[model samples]
Target: MGGGGGDGRSKELERLWAERDELDARIRLLESELETSSAAPASPAGEDAAAAGVGDGGCVGGGGACQARPGLAHADSLPADMIYRYSRHLLLPDFGVEGQRKLSRSSILVVGAGGLGSPVALYLAACGVGVLGIVDGDDVELNNLHRQIIHQEAYIGRSKVKSAADTCRAINSSIKVVEHHHTLKPNNALEVVRKYDIVVDATDNLPTRYMISDCCVLLNKPLISGAALGLEGQLTVYHHNGSPCYRCLFPNPPPVAACQRCSDSGVLGVVPGVIGCLQALEAIKVASDVGEPLSGRMLLFDALSARIRIVKIRGSSPACTICAENSVFTQEDFQKFDYETFTQSPMSDKTAPSLKLLPESARITCTEYKGLIDKGEPHVLLDVRPAHHFQIVSLSRSLNIPLSDLEEKLPMLETSMKETLDASAASDKQPSLYVVCRRGNDSQSAVQLLREKGFHSAKDIVGGLQSWAHDVDPDFPAY
Candidate 1:
């Protein structure tokens, strides 16, 4: 009787094990199907451009005759061997042979040869982009090696555009590398950008970024822009089919104080690496017409927490000082456009310094602003960082009125001051205006704002507070 019972139990266990194995096989099949479906490519645009019968040879429009025909440039077509070369892309459901041929026939211009540009150029080249035009005036530096991976240590101190072109060629010798060893300024931006199917902004400065955005918008070319600071970065595709240009999102240049540059503030070496990689992904999406590109959406990444946030940007602003519908930029206007004018401090005595100074004031660094309550500073710590940036890192006592917002928020300031004074009647001292921001530039602008508002005692902290922590106060966090 005991032997019979043991046999029944063993049979039941065998049945259960077989059922589990069958379920595992089903799961593996489902996962494989999901991956295959997700990797499928979307449809391509300019279908006629694909079906035009342009082969690996030069386009027929050129003033040259083919071996078999006279007065005709060889149709821009791919060779049979080239087709085999790009077979992996051709095998892709979305890219296929048609998309690979399209990429082989297309051309793109990349502006800047620094952090963002490095990854963009490398990926585009590796993807078999037919022609890549690089424009940059600066030389590679030792500091660039941290993020500018395209330039090797041996290439340091070499012209960035030249080095970048060499690197691109090394990756894919078939692709043409056009080098413009000059800056892309207002004068040359339109002309240079018009020659390519796409324009990429790998620039780090505000003026250059604005120039690239405006030129791409005017030329109706797609622009991919990316920027990084410390552990945070932002990227977006702009000026694609009447979508908002960069200026539409950020109308005028943020005041010098409000701009958070990697040079002044320092950045993690991997920040631009991550951001640039994303920019390259967007560029590839644009090139292949694959997944939806981040057009009109600012994709923000915080490396510290591995967090990504997307902010939808609206279309052109009617009041946008740069690219509004009514805005007209003529050749004459170019002469009057002063790039240096924006950097001038608003509190300069060149005007009326006397009227600029007024009543109560407080001073603090970006780092110290966090400890305002603990320090018991009797003032309001105003964040002068751009509103978008302020949202990323905000403190309890911080009130965000961007430097640009100052003109709009000025009138209410007096009432707020009075309320603060009333609230602190027991203290007898008037409430002071304490200005602070990331690194300290915007806070200086805030101090200037207070002076303009007739607040005399307004003073910006020395080294803006970042300096204070590094030099005067070792215990304070610099970031």
Candidate 2:
């Protein structure tokens, strides 16, 4: 019986050895597979960053203290406080612990701290995004309070980034907030944009919008964009897997005359607030992979009618400079386009056919013009600004004939100037016909038009009313 037992044990040992040999072969195969994979061509850096656990979409590096982690990884690693804090997110069936985990790893960069940036920063921080970066170069001004609610009167004259970051921290202290207190210029935009998983285009500047779009397309990141003016606003996303970029929507920026800044065209406070909060919703959806993003859809909001409309936007354009194969906007191509110059107000574009072309005799500084106004000089100050602006502020003795209506309303100007002309004949001159507008540009344009109409004495007020408020009268109200 003892000898039989020994034989049985020996047979068992042999069987075990056979299994061990088979396991070793499997291990060798896996090692070979891993080696092959390691040797294969790597994916794009942005893709690699995301794959490495950066986030649903996040940049893993800008060469500082950032270590790229899989945003979706380590679902079991949540701290007790984290679990408690994110219990609301965890309660959702579609977005529970997994979604919370993704948000904890996600990073976002918001490119403005004004009206749109306010709600975006606030909501993203409250949602517990892992990292938040705010880029702005403006100071908190009195005018910002109406719609830029994140900034307070206490923060007036403070840097917008600092003020915004303070508000974000007050709402949620667990997240990291980075203050990029300078403007997002063309040169630094790509570098800054590549370091975040998602970018929020809260900027109103056209060049900055294109800059953000180009960088996101190049980096393979997502963009949540928003804009509001008057009673209307638009919200959309771009460069998220398959979608049209801004250039696909607008290949070229509108001419300066067609452009309307928030300052130039008054915006309803709720209009921007609505668009900004929607921007936050899109960003969170992107970060947590929760809902359908606005990649191929644009949300148009009409505050006047209180209606929201979602419309389909066309897909990528083959001719698109940034989103197409062999696209025109390469890393090198960005350098060729002058975003700095493009974003400046039309007054600064420098394409102005010499002020000299309008003639030195056809222009007067605000001081010289102020002197004529004070001396009761019989001159007709033709305020060629639009009717709306004329209503905002106007000289006591000026006529409002908008530039678009200037040619048609020549009779109105002639009738008004007849008295000045008759009085000037007694003094051997006519009340100098002076053209004025918000800035000096439209006034200059008006002066040229007048000259073409045989009213050669028409001269543009240098710097227009803005210069008037700045140089001539300290108390003259200016927008």
Candidate 3:
């Protein structure tokens, strides 16, 4: 009886497998039907230009001038590859052939090819945007690989735009990827922004974000902005019809010390990935006119709680300083604006006077510090990096007291050194305290603070461990 039951169960399993295969076949058929049904592409404003034999950059009649070929706006003549590629988009009523054609004609400029730009560029390229312009002056770093997914391990030292363009091209060879491998200062912001139909503020810096927003508003182009730091991210569309610019939402930046950067606070790789993809989706909605844009609304995402909420914002802010009728930034301002100096705190600023006040003797070079350690000289090496980083790869001779907690733990630092440190030293001048941080910037600040607290002999290791990795020890981990 048991043998008979086993045979019967096996036959039932076979029937279920056969049913699954049938459903899979039906899915393929439906996908093909959607593709063929939407084979008819609408004639966009650019179609007339292609028919008129306009040069790639010549007049495209009503759709402005063509940047590449007027290969967009395919009316009833969608390329065979495109039909297969955009099958899913074609199936959706919101983004059928008409929407795809619009996307094909649209050009978007993505600023800051970093964390947020990674997923945004990927999705937009794969979805078939005709032209993608990436602007970034920074180079890819070992630390950036965690969230900046577009750049790979091999691209550690390459310009971010070059790496980003390479990745986007590999994803979709049909689109044109332009690399602006220079900083977008006020001098060049207008020249670059005026060419694109839309701007994506993938930048994290306040100066660049404000610059991009102001430029888009001046050019009457829509802006899709997104930001992710730590586990939280925010997204919104700005400068659309009756929509408020970024200045309307944030007139001033948060205090620099209070502002949290991913380098300091840390970020889950997936957090920015999620926000970037959403930015792409909203940009697509604006470009293709498929759904209501995020203009006049902001989406807040909390990765910890896995929650997303959309809050309404005023379409126009009467008190908005920049976008208001009588505020600031006329079209000419884009040309003469001193964005670099205006937004950046000069090195001569009061807050950064540590290097000025601290004598040259208070800072030791990485090579000098290495010699001290080699001679078994008694000294306290205080690492002012985050505790998690110390756990990853740290010097055995160093003690971790993150810069933020250093002041409160000063007593611990002093007592620990007095009791146990420099035990084998020949002479006792009370071992000098030496500070180090990721890049030497924070280490200088810590040393300055220690000097003020009467640790006159305390000094910072110049260029921190980064210099050590470069000059003294190649095996020292950088990131």
Candidate 4:
């Protein structure tokens, strides 16, 4: 019966894979159609010249000869389809035809298609932004689906840039959706950012945030930045209208330990959704030259308390290396800036770093531990992950002692060891002490602490529970 159940699950997985492949093929076909349509004959040379104000640093369109507002430069009159599609927006007094026209002329580059970028791209596409560029090098994964709403279950294992661009095109196929299926580094950031009127810093890491902000400042583009983690979110518009850049506020990077990501801290899906929507709001406001944007002010959101607050942040600093008048931080310097080294943290958080605090003798592989378990050896499996994580998933009979409380619970650990040794009728012999965590890093630290406390036999599982799931038991949940 168990074998039959496994076979059924395998077949279901195969079917899902086939469906995902079909969906991918359809998306590619749609993208090709869009490209072909875009390549069709351009407007008359006179019209092209009049609308040539895009990307050349003039207004969105309104070449010197054109009299229409920057928004209306696309055409003397709105198209019939555009009128019906954006009727609600055109009805607004503040953002009527003029606002819609500006939006239609503006271009925005969203630098991450994850949680924040998902909503920003979706709303911008729906609002008829003339050109939207998505930048991401990661492939979709099951874990990203919770907060990264732009990606579907079928998009898993596909490029995030392609998935997000496809969704945006689906929402508004009239607009131009540019897919930059690569991570933005210092070398390519300037070239990618210069083409857009505004840049959105939807990226999650510090290095990328600083990199994007610096790029915007160098290229004279406004930046809409948003971040969310653990039921909290923040939004700010940097480098706009004499506002301070990110470096003006944070001259020094925060400690690596303090920079928690959604993966580590766990974000409520709606938190980023709220912040990303606000980011879209700010981008629209700035793009249309309408209501005030959140420049030099930070919006803080606390989902747990259901509170939203906007606070004034510092103005641009004279000493700001990149944005100040007297500063010499040029495009050349920006191209060569080593953001990871400056921030002392990696630019991407795709994987946790492996820790090697102990010698080979002090760590055991999951496979070796499985051997001991199969032989019915009397041993204690100590899970050093937090209590909540242990509750989520843990090996049977493993004791939970969070790494934070391990030192305080030394006596408890001693008692548990004593009990295990007595049960094995080997009280005189040292009890085997094996430590584990979600990953191997914390377990290594826990083992180091135990050894210092004279628990000489303490050893950590090399890759912790992740390796156990990968090697010893594929059925175990990794997260």
Candidate 5:
């Protein structure tokens, strides 16, 4: 028994000795990465030497140290804390200390602080991009929390730029964060984009995308653009390495009806997260000169099917209006460009446009509808929302007929209206018809179609069920 106990103790001592050796090796590696080489200049005492001049485009390389800017005196090697913090990155064969140095010297401007901007800003800031600029004019809303992970519940009513900048700073105080609390527009696009090494197109509208890409082309800056809608997303790099600019591919904008916003057609929250991460990756690769960028290629992600495909896109066009070799699209021209007119879409697509297809007399207010309900008026309420949305919520005694299938279902709708009017025993009075949807926009079209089909009494409920939930019943579900 004594021999067995001695054997166990011997094994325990051996294990402890092995652990000590491993720890010693790790410590030595950490020290080697943190040490200032003899050829590099010594850093001043009691200073954050590693992060100096990073905000002013101070690059590093050639001699295993962060190179000083033209006039600034900076550190020779990474600080001990930073060496430990980025140890994983430092250990990478492809992206070693040199890559981190280059990344820390680059500045990036993210155009929107929404879903895509959330992850893009967060990763760039965490990865130690030197100067991170966030430009947005929007305030955080309750609905944005699902996909905009950078914002907190408490920041619901605050400016998105301020909220995102604060979060990025909280994640990495070593980097500099700039907040531009205004939307990018033709007047300021050139000025705002001129300072950054790379531009990220995280905005959600075609007008803004065109304006930004044009500005990038004018400024000779690389553009990493990403978009996510519904359960799908697409990403591409514009204006980099002979890649086509946005205008090169899309010479003409799509029809206004084809431009759908997430506010109209719902989007899966995580869809933007996947695309945003790739955008950040591409930006890092471009900044660090590490990997091949997504230039001249498009990445399509289908979230529902869990698939990602990269296809070759076209190169820069010689006859392209803005990016061709003989092109003369100057900054002055960009300043005078009418993006809204060209795209036929608003720069901010937060809500669907309210159509005035019917006169005021043909539209009934939600309060009037509530009065009709209270007085037991004889009217047929037709819900024209999509079938899936109709299943989400509907008022009692309302018939469901999606606007897409309205022409096919008109006969059924007429029968229901006839039954409602006949049941009221009003032989002389015309049948009362009301149409509703999630928003008031689609109901107007339904009313227009019904009126053309001889149902002149079909009046739209102004502001649709959304206004009904707000003005009629506070307990009704808004979504």
Candidate 6:
């Protein structure tokens, strides 16, 4: 009886080994079939649109064709383990296990590491996203710390992208972080965006924002965009299949006079943080395929009053140059388009003059003005700030001329000059006029206005009195 039992056990072991070998052979055969099938001929357009239908609407990779099987919906239904793992998401009818898995598998790319990028990167990383990519070419500075919170005090001189990446990784090790230590431009935008499923626009400048929108629309990828000025912030999801793109709304950037930049108008520290987090939420919604995303609507937030407003965006414009021909996707089409010319602000010469206008030639900073003053250079310094600011802080030998009162006050300067001329009985010398304001932006406009009125030797303080007070005399009071 013992001999018979031993023989039966040996036979059972042989059968199990035989079955394992057969399974290994089958796997190898399936891999070979996938390789051959993926190498099949491509369609004329270079994009494998035919391959788009594979794998139950999920992206298919390699040679094995994704076969649609019946009961796939049931297969995607919540399992015991999945339900337990994603219990929090399962509580919401809109976000079940399937939606959670979709989010877990999606990748997103965020451009810039400044104000808008900070909240977008932090929230996305903390939300269990599978992968996150950051692109930035700037270094952290003492001034940037006011709004850019991702970088710590120790990382003041470090690269912004690297510092941001470190913060994201520290939040979630499961998230794959890719850092690009360069600016995102036309030459590299498409290539960089192609690797990710979604793009988030956190860049401040107009050129980079336009480039990101165009690339996303062309590639048929979704983009979550946000921008802030003063206390107001704007948020939108652009380039989704059914939604209008960034160009569809604006068509072109606003005229220079109407355009407001952070440099010109100061932004509240928490304003961007509020707006950027909304952008991150929009991105997560797109990834999860759950709830109503901000695809066709713009959300505006006023931090000071705590108000939220929504603006609905209609379909794409028939005259849109970027989305009209779907011209943004292919490298050839993007190459043919002139981005530099496209992003250039409309010529301000054609528009009516405001309080002051900045000419195209001046590039002076406030630091330069202080040096000139210290050297006892024979130049006239004009304070273009409001009377309150001037009364609070004024440099020695500087004349108070508010930008708003410039036209009315010009005659007074001329009258004073005439008196000086009569007393001295000498010819009038062209006194070099240097303009300054709270920040350097308005001073440039003041200088340009002076030039238009025949003050040819006018100059602008680069960073205004703020830089002057910080660099020249720390004891001076700052407004």
Greater-lDDT candidate between 4 and 6 = 4
Candidate 2, residue 425: Cα displacement in angstroms equals: 9.7
* Candidate 6 to truth, TM: 0.69
lDDT of 6 by residue, 1-479 (tens): 78999999999999999998666545534643464366556443223222221112222222112212234346455323334444787687787666766665577889988898998899887765556789988888776788888989999889999999999978754456789998887778888888788899997666566778888877888999999989999988887857878888888776656666665556888898898888888998998887788878889898878999998889777778777764434667774666546766421111212333454355455666667767755556778888867887788867888898987798865564455445543345544577788767677777777778877777777667877888877887764
Residue 221 displacement (Å), model 6? 0.3
Clashing pairs in 6: 38-63, 357-445, 358-445, 364-462, 365-462, 366-462, 366-463
lDDT of 1 by residue, 1-479 (tens): 68999999999999999998666545534543443345435334332222322223311111111112322333344444455566687678977756666665566788888888899899888777656789988888887788889998888878999899999878775566789999876666666776677777887776667667767666667988899987899998887744688767766567666865665566888888888888877877786677788887889999989999999888667765556678786544543455435433221111211222223344444455446556766666566777666655555656677777787787666666677777774567877677656555566667876786787555564354456566556765544
Per-model TM-score versus the true fold: 0.58, 0.80, 0.78, 0.85, 0.84, 0.69
Worst 10 residues of 3 by lDDT: 58-67
C-alpha local distance difference test of each model: 0.67, 0.79, 0.77, 0.84, 0.84, 0.71
Clashing pairs in 3: none
lDDT by residue (tens digit), candidate 4, 247-324: 999989999999988777788898889999999999999999999999989999999899999999989999998899
- Show the lowest summed lDDT stretch of 10 residues, model 6: 52-61
Ranking by TM-score: 4, 5, 2, 3, 6, 1
| Clash count, one per candidate | 14, 7, 0, 2, 0, 7
Query: What is the Cα root-mean-square deviation between model 5 and the actual structure?
Result: 8.6
lDDT of 3 at 452: 84
The all-Cα superposition gives candidate 4 an RMSD in Å to the true structure of: 10.3
Q: How does model 2 score by TM-score?
A: 0.80
What TM-score would you give candidate 4 relative to the actual structure? 0.85
